[model samples]
Structure formats: C-alpha cells, structure tokens
Target chain A: MLELDRVGVALGPKAIFNDLSLTIGPGESVCLVGPSGAGKTTLLRLAAGLLAPTSGEVTNGFRETSVVFQEPRLLPWRRVTDNIALGLKARGIGRRHRRARARELAAAVGLAESLDCFPHQLSGGMCQRVALARALAVGAELLLLDEPFSALDVGLRSDAQQLMQQLVQERALAMMLVTHDLIEALRLGHRVLVLAGSPAALVYELPVTTPFNERTPAWLHEAAARLLRQPLVQASFQPLVDREAA
Target chain B: MAAWVRRLLRGIGSLTGVLLLVTLWEWGSIRYGSFMLPGPRDTLTAMGRLAEQQALLAAMWATSWRAITGFALAALAGMALGLLAGLSRTLGRVLEPVATVLLGIPPIAWIVLAILWFGSGSLASIYTVAATTLPIAFAGAQMGARTLDARLAELATAYRLPLAQRLWDLYLPHVVSYVFPALITALAVAWKVTVMAELLATDTGIGAGLALARVNLDTAAAMAWVVLVVVLLLVAEHGVLRPLQRRMEPWRTGH
Candidate 1:
C-alpha cells in the first residue's frame, strides 16, 4: 500500500499540494484526473518518492515500486530489450535471467519483434510499450504511471489502455495512474479521483464499480458525461476548458 | 547509387584529392630543387634508408608510445576529475576556471616547463602531451555530467538502481556521448604535443629525428619524418579511435 496523509508540498513560494491524503491498497487501481498544471505530476512524484512533502507523512509499504512517466524514458543508447531489462538489472538480476524476463514482458506488451531495435527506431507507442515493459520487469507490486498513454493516437491509446488493464488484472498489481483524460481514467481505474483548485487537493472521489473488461466506449462516454455535468467537476475543469476555447 | 558504390565513389574522390595535393607538391619541389622542399620520391628514398637502418621503426615506436601513454593518463585523470566536478557544484566552480587556465596555457610553454622538470627525455614529451590534452577531456566529461537528464535521474530513483548499475547503465552511457568526441580531439592534441615536445626535449622520437635531419641539412629526411608522423596519426584515428567509436556508439549509427 502507498499512503499519503495530509501531505503538503511547496515548491519555493508556490504551494502545489495542500492537506492531501490518499491510499492505494494492493490490487487497487486509482486514477487521478485534473486540469493541466494542477499538480498531478507533483502528486505522482510524491508517491514515487521522487519528491518530499513539506508537511505530513508519506509512507509506501509496497516492497517494490515502478513508475512510467508522461514520456518514455528509455535510455537512447540501449536496445529495446536492454531498456526493458533496466529495472531488472537494477534489482541485481543476472543478465540472462533479466533478459529472458524482459523478453517475456516485451512480448506481453506487444513488442516481441522490436527487442533488438533502439528506442529511437521505435514509434512513440512502441517506445511507451517498452517503458511499460521495463516497469513490469522489476516485478513491482505498486506501479505509478503519469499520463503514460497521453502521447499516443486514439487507437494506440485505447490499445495501451487495454494492455494496461489486462496486465494490472492478471498480476493483481496496485496502480495509481494520473491523466487529464476523463474516459481514460474511468476505463482503467477501480476508483477515480479528481484533483483541482489552488494548492490542489482531491475535490471528488468516485468508485468505478464497472469491471475493467466490461467498460465499453458507450458506457465510458455516458459515465464521463455524467461526471462532467457535476458542479464540482465542471468548476474544476472550467479553467482548462476556457483555456482550450481561448 | 547503392551504398557500396557510393562509398567507392567517395574513396575515389579522396584519392583524386590526394593526387591533386601530390601534383602541387611535385610542382613546388621541381621549382625549388630537391635540396629545399624535396620531392615525394626523394622523401620516400630517405625513408627507405631510415627503414634499412631500423631508425624509422624505432623512432615511430617511441613517438607512438609517448603519445598513447600520455593520452591514456590524461583521459583517466581528466574524466575522473571532470565527473567529480560535474557532480558537485562547489567542485565545478573550483575546477572549471582551473581547466580554462590549463587550456589557455600553450603546448609550447608546457613543453618548455616539462623539459625543465623532466630533464629532456620521453617523460618530458609525455608530460607535455598530457598537460596539453587534459583540459579537452575534462571539459567534455564535465559538460556531459552536468547536462544529465533529470527525468533519467528520477527514473533511476523510481526503479531503485544500485550505485554500480547507475554508473554503468545510466551515467556512463550519457557521459560517453560527450566524452568520446572530446577524447578524439584530445588524442589529436596528444600526438601534436608529443611531437612538439620531442622536437625540443627528447632524443629518440620522430620529432627528434626531424631535429637530427635539420642538423644534417637533410630536407628529404625531414619531410620523410613529417610524412611518417601524419601516417601514424591517420592510422591511430581511423584504425583505432573511429572503430572504437563505432562500436561504442552503434545506436547513434542506426545500423
């Protein structure tokens, strides 16, 4: 489990997170959605232990943790197989063993044919799959992803989302995924949380009772439309919608 | 054209350029007599005499050893110090100016200082070469280390990379991109500085052979020594460094 209790984060004089408390238990997938610049990445960073909260306690009880960033962060010099094996190598797994595991993960993520290619040679979605495979290679009980599929086209995005849902279910892995896309959040997460307002804190929390495999496009759209119609969700995303309009 | 055919065309172009340079050289030699500049044939004959005496091989070996050894020392020390400086802001501030000062100091000045310290031998030439080339390697490594991607560092933390793995997998790969180019430049500087130092302070290298040739007023022999130095440099660059660079940076080549 990863728990953040009344965590407050201040970057210089600007407060990003204030009195934010959350918990992600084993086998639970939590999705956070918010407008751009609403401290979504900061919150993920805090959960990943890459940032320290200015106040309150942040505790991660998971034995291992892995993160997938907004952009794929594979080492450019390493081949796809080696890149996917990075986290395994970090855990001191032997070369042959880690590579074998990496191959399996790559195949699972639909990158079996591109193992020998470098990151640059792969497309954006393929590179993101490699990054996903790398995160899985460590065998982390908790996976924290920050907009992992935001860069892909709609088709690839849905494909990646489906892949993620399947993996999370099969492994019984705990996940905290952050994104601005409402449908994406609803489609994959067991519980969806909304973060908004100045010095961001969770404004709404909704349990998504629909099964991962059962959440179809129409249901997702109808669900998202209902959530968007809520006064709090409207108020939270107003600035973002206004900015896009402008 | 096919890749190999294009490569062959490029090779032929290089040969043509070399032939053009030789033609100009022959023209100059004919105008100024063999006593002055010396024709390529005269230099080749002089080289043959030196080879028969085994002086050419011994001189080439000595010069190559000093240059290679000095470059190795500089690469080790400079990269170590550069990595240290890059990792710490205070160390970077303290050492960056020192690197700049070292770079500012001329190779000739270093040669003179080295001769006074090492007293006219291979050590003096080697020291001079190391001093002249150290700053180049240092700057490359420091830039590389300083410009490390913060995202990669975060990824390292998230993945819980061990220190050894961090250095080998994370840091070294990033640093090598910057360091390799610097090392190539430093290697070229190493050879030049070694020759310059040998000309003044040594008695057994190609530069020293040039000094001997000058004393005997043997212009052909001097030209022959110069040619030998150029060939050695070319061999070192193309045969060793380029191949090593290609191996280390196969990703960059996209092959």
Candidate 2:
C-alpha cells in the first residue's frame, strides 16, 4: 500500500499542491488526470519518494517501488537488456541471475529480439517498452508512471496500455498513472482522480468497476464522454484554457 | 562499393597526398641543396645509417617510454582531481582557475623549471611532459563530469542504485567519452613536450638525437629524427587512441 496523507508541496516560494491526499492499495490501479502543469508529474514524484512534501506524511508499505517517466529515460550506452536489468542491479543481484530475469521481462514486453540493441537503435515505442520492463524487473509492488504512453502514436498507445494492464494484473501490482487523456484514464484506472487549479487538489473521483478485458473501445469512449460531461470535470480543466486566452 | 574496397580507396587517397609532399620536399632539396634541406632519399639513408648503429631503436624506445609514463601519470591524476572538482561546487571553483593558469603557462617555461628542479635527467623530461598535458586532461574530464545527464541521475536515484554501481555504470561511461578525447589531445602534446624537454634537459631520446645532429651539422640526421617523431605520433593517434575510442563508443558510431 502507498499513502500520501494530506500532503502539501511547495517549490521555493510557490506552492504546487495544498492538502492533496491519495492512496493505492495492493492490486489497485488509479489514474490522475489534469491539464498540463497542474502538478500531475509533481504528484507522481512525491509518491515515488523522489520529492518530499512540505507538510503531511507519506508512508510506503511496498518493499520496492519503480517509476516510468514521461520520457523513456533509458541510458543511451546500455543495451536493452542491461537497461531493463538496472533496477535488479541496484538490488545487488548477481549478473547472470539479473540478466536472465531481464531477458524474461524483455520477452514479456515484446522486446525479445531487441535485447542486444542499444536505446538509440530502438523506436520510441520500443524504448517505452524497455522502460516498462525496467520498472517491472525489480519485482516492484508499486509502480508510478508519469504519462508513460503519451509520446506513442494512437496505435502504439493502445498497445502499450494493453501491455501495462496485463502486467499490472499478472503481478497484482499497485499502480498510479498520470495522464491528460480521459479515455486512457477510463480504460486503465480502477479509480480516476481529476486535479484542478493552482495549488491543485483533487476535484473529483470516480471508481470504474468494469473488468479489464470487458472494457471495449466503444464502451471506453462512451464512458470517457460521460465523465467529461460532468460539471466538475469541465471546471477542473477550464482554468488553464481561460488563462491561455487571457 | 564494398566496405573494404572503400577503405582501400581511402588509403590510396592518403598515400597520394604523401607522394605529393615527398615530391615537394625533393624539389626544395634540389633548389636549396642537400646541406640545407635534405631530400627524402638522403633522410631515409640517414635513418638506415642510424638503424645500422642500433642508436635509432634505442632513441625511439627511450622517447616512447618517457612520453607514455608522463601521459599515464597525467591521465590518472588529472581524471581523479577533475572528477572531484566537477562533483563539488567549492572544489570546482578552487581548482578550475588553477587548471586555467597551468594551461596558460608555456611548455618551454615548464621544461626550464623542471630542468632546474630535477637537474637535467629523465625526471626533468617526464615532469615537463606531465605538467604540460595535465591541464588539458583535467579540463576534458571536468567538462565530462559536469555534464552528466540529470535525468539519468534521477533514474538512478529512483532505482536506489548502490554507490559502486552508480559510479561504474553511470558516472564512468559518461566521463570516459569526454575524457577519451582529452586524453588523445594530451597524448599528442605529451610526445612534443617530451621531445622539447629532452632536447633542453636530458641526454637521451629523439630530442637528444636531434641535438647531436645539430652539433655535427648533419641536416639529413636531423630530418630523420623529425620523421621518426612524426611516425610515432601517427602510430599513437591513429593506431592506438582511435581504435580504443571506437571500441568504447560503439553505440555512438551506430555499430
């Protein structure tokens, strides 16, 4: 379980979050949706323990945690297998054991043939897959991803989403994914949280009980449309556009 | 064209340039006379004569030894200090200007000081070479260490990389890329500076051989020594440094 209890984060003099609280239990998938610069990435960083909240408490009960960033962030010099094995290496695992585990994860993520290829040789989608495999390699109980599939094209996005969904189910991993795409939120999250305004706080939360395999594309789109029709969801996104126009 | 054939063509093209230089040298020799400017053949003959005396191999060996030892010292010390300075702001401020001052000082000035301090021996020559090349290596290594990608650092932090793994997998590879080019530059400087220091302060190596030729007024012998130095530098650069760089940066080369 991961918990951010009434967290407040301030960067220098400016506050990015005030009184924001969220939790992810074992095997739960939560999606955070907001406009750009609404502190979605900041919230993920806080959860990953990469950032400390200015006030309140963060307690992570998971043995291991991993993050996949907006960019793949694969080390350019390391081959795909080595990059995927990074988290395992951090745990002081033996070379042969870690490499075997990396190979298995690479095959699982559809990168079996690209194990020897460097990050520079892999496509954007392939690089994301490598990042995903790296996050899984540590046997992390909690995975925090910040817009991991945003850079992929539509076809690749859906493919990556399916991969993420399958992996999360297989491992019974707790996940918190941040993205701006409503349909993506509807498709992946067991619960969706919408963030709004300066010093952003959660504006709305909705729990989707549909099984992963049962959520068809048309159903996802219709569900997303229904969520977007809510006054709070519209208001949550309005401030950024109004500011842009101003 | 096939890759090997293309490489062969490139070799031939470079050979043509060398032939052109030789032709120009021969023309200059004829116009100015062999006493003033030895022809390529005369220099070659002088080289053969030195080889017969066994002096040529010994001189080449001494010069290579001094240059390589000095370069090794400079590389180890400079890389260690540069990495330290790069990692800490206070240390960087203290060391960066000192490096700049060292770089500003001329190699001849260093050689003279080294000879005074070490009393005209191998120590003098080695010290001069190391001092002249250390700043260059330090600057390269410092830049490399300073420019480590912050994103990767974040990734390492998130993964909770152990200190040893962080240094080996993250810091060293990035630093080597910058340091390798600096080391190559320092190496080229090492050869020239060693020869200069030897000519002034030592009685061995290629520089001393050039001095001997000067005293005897043997233009061909002097030219031969110059030729040997050039050959050694080319062998060090193209034959050694380039191959090492290629091996280390295979990803950068798309290989």
Candidate 3:
C-alpha cells in the first residue's frame, strides 16, 4: 500500500495540490484524472519519491517501486533487451539471469522479436512497451504510470490497456496511474479520483465496481454518462474550457 | 539509399576530390619551375631517393610519436576537466573562459613558450600539440555532457542504478559520440602543430628534414615530405576516425 497522507505541494509560493489524501491498497489500481497543469505529473513524481510534499507524509509500504514517465526514457545506446534488463543489472543479477528475465518481459510485452533491436528501431508504442517491460523486470510492488498509453493509437492503446490490466490481476500489482482520458481510467482503475480547481484538489472519488476484465463498451459508456452527471466532473473541465474560450 | 550504394558514391566523390587537388598542384608546379615548386614526378623521385637513404622512416616515426603522444595526453586531460566543468555550473563558468582564451591564442605563440619550458626536442613539439588541441577536446566533452537528457537522470534515480552503472551505461556513451568526432579534428591539429614545432625547435623528425631541404633549396624533397604528412593524415582520418565514428553512431544499430 502507498499512502499520501493529507499531502500538500507548493512551488514558489503557489499551491499545486493541497491536503490531498489517497491510498493505493495492496491489490488496488487507482487512477487520477484531471485537466492540464493540474499537477498530475507532479503528483506522480511525488508518489514515485522523485519530489517531496510541502506538508504531510507519503508512506510507501511496498518493497519496490517503479515509474513509467510520459516519455519512453530508453537508453539509446542500449538494445531493447538491455533496456528491459536495466533494473536487473542494477540489482547485480548475473548477465545470464538478467538476459533470461529481460527476454521473458520482452515477450510478455509483445516485443519478443525486438529483443536484439535498439530503442530507436522500435515504434513509439513499442518503446513504451519496453519501458513497461523495464518496470516489470524490477518486480515493482507499486508502479506509478503517467500517461503511459497516451502516445499510442486507439487500437494499440486498448491492447496495451488489456495487457496492463491482465498483468495487474495476475501479479496482484498495485498501480497509481494519471491520465486525462476518463474511459481509460474507468477501464484500468479500481477507483478513480477526479481533481479540480486551478491548483488541483481531490474533488470526487468514484469506486469502479466493475472488474477491469469484465467491463464492456456498453458499461463504459453508461459509466461515463453517470460520471458526466456529477457537477464536479463537469466543473473540472470548466476552468480549462474557460481558459480556451478566453 | 542502400548502404553499399551510399558508400560507393562517397568513395567515388573522395577520389574525385583527391584528383582535383593533385591536378591543381601540378598546374601550380608547372607555373613555377621545379627549382621553385616541384612537380608530382620530381617530388615522387625525391621521395624514392629519401626512402633509399633510409632517413624517411626514422623521420616519419619521430614526428608521428610526438603527434600521437601529445594528442593522447591532451585528450585525457581535456576530457577529465571537461566532465568536471560540464557537471557543475560554477566550474563550467570558470573553465569555459579559460578554454576560450587558450583557443584564441595562436599555435605559433605556444611553440615559443613550449620550447622555453621543455627545450628543443620531442617534448617541445608534444607540448605545443597538446596546448593547441586541449581546447577542442575540452569543448567537445563539455557539449557532450550538456546533451545529457535530464529525464534519463530522473529515470536512473527512480530505478536506483548504481553510480558506476550510470556512468558506464548512460554518461560514457553520449560523451564518446561527441568526443570521438572532436578527437578526429584534434588529430589533424596535433599533426600540424607537431610539424610546425619540430621545424623550429628540433633537429630530428620530418619537419627538420623539411628544414634541411629548404636550406639546400631542394624544393622536390620538401614537397615529398609534405606529401608523406598529407597521406598519413588521410590514413588517420579515413581509415581510423571515420570507421570508429560509424561504429559509435548508436542509431546505426537500429536497422
């Protein structure tokens, strides 16, 4: 479990997120959905321990944590296999074992043939998969993903979402994902947190009763319609709409 | 374009450039008599004569040693200091101006100081080459270090990669890309500075042989020595540097 205990974040006197308390349980996936500049990335960074909160505490109960940034962050010099093996290499795993584990993850992420190839040779979606493989290679207890599938096309995105959801359930992994796409959040997360205000505050929490695997397109549509009915959900977009209108 | 076709075109273009240069040299030699400027034929004969004398090999080895030694030393020092400077803002600000000042000074200016410090021999020639080439290597290393993506640094931190692994896997690869190209340029500068220093400061090396040829008004011998140096430069650039550079290009592994 990862806990953000009434966390407050400020950058140069301006508050970004304030008194935000959230917990991702041992077998739970929580998604944060909000507009741009709502500090979604900053929140991810805070959870990953890349940034410290201004006030309150972030308690990490997991043995290991991994982050998937918006970018692939693959080493250009390293081949796909080596990139996937990065965490394993850091852990002092022997070359043979590291190679074995990396190959497994590469296949897990549908990049079996690209094991020998460089990151530059892979497509954007493939590179993201390599990043995913890297995270999985570490055996992270809590995985923090910031728009991991935003760069992919709709077909690829759904495929990737399916893979991620399947892995989460199979491994009983805990995840904290931030995305602007409500449907994606609804599909992957056990619970979705909606952030609103100029500097974001957790305005609403929607517990996704439907399991990720069983949720159909019809259910997703009905759920989205139900979410749109919430005044706060509509209000979250108001600021962004007003800014664009101006 | 196909790799083989591209390579063949580049080879043809290079040969054409060399022929054009030789043609221009021949024209210049004809305009001025062989006494003043030797033709390719006269220069070739003079080179053959020197080879027969067995002096050409010794002179070539002596000058080459000085150039390589000085270049190697400069590369090590410049890269070390450049990493320190590039990683720290305060160090970069302090050292960047010093490098710029060193670069602005003429290579000729360094030879006089080098001779005074090391006295006339390989030391002076080597020192002069190092002094002249240091700024180039330093600049290359600094820029290479600067090209590092901050996002990668964050990634490394998140993953908890060991310091040695970070340096080996991330930092060195990017630095080598910048450093190797600069080293190629530095190699050219090293040879030029070594020869220039040897002409004035030393009684041995190819430069000294050129001095001898000059005093005796043997224009063909001087041109032959010049040709030898140019050929060596071409070998180092095309045979060594270009091949190494191609291998270092990380994206080449993509296909």
Spell out the clash pairs found in candidate 3.
none
Instruction: Give one digit per residue, the lDDT tens place, for model 1 in B1-255.
Output: 799999999999999999999999999999999998899999999999999999999999999999999999999999999988998999999999999999999999998888788898999999998998899999999999999998898888888888898889889989999999999999988988888889999889999999999899999999999999999999999999999999998999877
**Candidate 3 per-residue C-alpha lDDT over A1-246 given as tens digits, one digit per residue, 9 for 90 to 100:** 899999999999899988988888897999999888888888899999999999999999999999998889999988999999999999999999999999999999899999988887889999999999999998998999999999899999999999999989999999999999998899999999988785688888999988676799899888988997899998887788888999
Error of 1 at A65 (Å): 2.2
Question: Which prediction has more favorable DockQ, 1 or 2?
Answer: 1
Off by over 4 Å in 3: B1-6, B27-32, B246-255
RMSD of 3: 2.0
Residues A61-171, candidate 2: write the lDDT tens digits.
999899999999998888998999998988989999999999999999999999999999999999999999999999989999999999999999999999989998888
Clashing pairs in 1: none
Estimate every model's Cα lDDT from 0 to 1: 0.93, 0.93, 0.91
lDDT of 1 by residue, A1-246 (tens): 899999999988999988899999999999999898999999999999998899999999998899999999999999998999998887778999988998899899998999899898999999999999998888889999999999999999999999999999999999999999999999999999999989898999999998877899999999999999989989999988888999
- For each candidate, the DockQ is 0.81, 0.75, 0.72
The local lDDT score (0 to 100) that residue B21 gets in candidate 2 is 98
Ranking by TM-score: 2, 3, 1
Kindly report which residue stretches of model 2 are placed more than 4 angstroms away from their true locations once superposed: none
Scored against the native two-chain complex, candidate 2 gets a DockQ of 0.75
Q: What is the TM-score of chain B alone in each candidate?
A: 0.97, 0.97, 0.93
